[model samples]
Target: MSTATVASAPPAPRVQKRGTPLAKKRQWRAAYLFVIPFFVVFITMLIVPLFYSGYLSFFATRLVGGTSFVGFDNYVKTFTDPLFLAGVGRTGLFLLVQVPIMLGLALFFALALDSGRVRGSKVLRLLIFIPYAIPGVVATLMWGYLYGQDFGPIVQVLSALGLGSPNLLSDSNVLGSMMNIVTWEFVGYNMIIMYSALRSIPAELYEAAEIDGASQLRVAWSIKIPAIRPAILLTVIFSIIGSFQLFNEPSLLRNIAPNAISTSYTPNFYAYNLAFVSQNVNYAAAVAFILGIVIMIVSYVVQLSTQRRERLG
Candidate 1:
């Protein structure tokens, strides 16, 4: 009797599998969970501040009228301001001079390393990269001390060697000194980028070149350099951004060389002085926004030129 009852109850309904819609919904939920944090932080930290700055840039806060909308007056003033123009020109010069030297050195080092012929290449690479690991403030301070005319080690050594101590932080030479410091700091970082790109090239290309009796220089010029153009472009873009955003080094060096490094030495430095020192937040916002636009335009031009060259080639 038990066996008969068990057999009668044996028939059960089949469970249906979930549809694609349901599975997709679950996947979308997981994706949102992963991405929500980034969006939240980005909106809170960047988007909101940018919009607020843009809002501030259109208004004027004065002693008598309080805060009142002035339309594009702040922006017009920013475009015409000599201080702002000087800073822009200064940074443009910095980009032109420093970026070339830095990138050249970086490419040289990367090519040497990629050749696989340099002894203790790993050690040399690490040594080159160590400066970048140092904090910008620390690096600036370290360099500032070296550039000190009165008591710095460099000056002392020069004086001891009966060579007159040249003023590195002087008005005439300070920009070049800054360039040297920047080149020292960033060469390794750019080298690593180029080196990584070089390493990714197909080994068969090198083999083919070898079979064609190509010298190492010929192989690098024809294959490696062309292959790594994108990496070079990336480094150039980064250098351009960094050059325009040049603030920390100049700001820190101001204390060391007040006569040479002005409060408005760089666009960023000018913006900071306007906002904090002069208490002109509205104008400062406008200046900062304008500077951001300049950087975008310059970077866009560079990218466009690169693309055009690629198309032509």
Candidate 2:
């Protein structure tokens, strides 16, 4: 024991040597250098502006030096505004009807294209997706012209077929017409998303299903749909968000059918009109914030409900 103690084990090989302060400082500097740009941009563009908006939302601005803190008056006014409520209701209606139809068409097209037996699949896919590449303003303009009652080819065709041409740009039919435009522009985008999901599914699953006597339809329903459920949910959420944000199409089309789409056609359009036309920035902020919250809550609920159903099944 005494001989072993005399060896002293060389101070346990300095197992926990601490770094110098200069070395620690250099490590911290490198980390900050890597992270600073992101923080700088986020703070400058997002955080600061958001905080500024929050502050601005508390006051009512006037033409003269008459800005005054109004507290929640703007929000109260927004809630009571019939035009705002109508816009919200119209957007909800569009979300309920158009989103499902558009996404359904997208899923169908994606599935059709992903099936190896389809002829001219590549060309068809390119043709389908080309509409999405057109600018929204341009698409709206073109479709607005086509939907024209006086000189449109559709009207001419209806006249030729001895069927009376209904006014597509009337107040009663404008929402449906806009829905058609949105579907044409975005179905391809959603199709691409679903197609990507379809491509990622392993061939082995389909092969195994085929070996088990599953028909193509059964395989698509059981394997393909379940596999791409997440992408489907994503497209649905995006469609819902977009339906609420409907502006450019109706706004641009207003030139052709002014009475059909007023200043407040959708929630986003309502906010725009409030801010610019009404000169009510505070009310616009309130409406914008409310719309954002509604979208977030709806998306969260949809995701949760879908996930729960999947888990339970």
Identify the candidate with maximal TM-score. Answer: 1
All candidates: CA RMSD (Å): 8.0, 8.3
For candidate 1, give the lDDT of residue 198: 99
lDDT of 2 by residue, 57-103 (tens): 78898888778999988778878889888999999999999999999
Positional deviation of 233 in candidate 1, in angstroms? 0.9
Candidate 1 backbone collisions, by pair: none
Write the residue-wise lDDT of candidate 1 on 1-313 in tens digits: 4334443453434312444444345556766877999999999999999999999999999877799999999999988899999999999999999999999999999999999999999999999988899998999999999988999989889989999999989998899989998999999999999999999999999999999999999999999999999999999999999999999889999998998988889999999999999989999999999999999999999999999999999
lDDT of each: 0.92, 0.89
Give the CA lDDT, 0 to 100, for residue 285 in model 2. 85
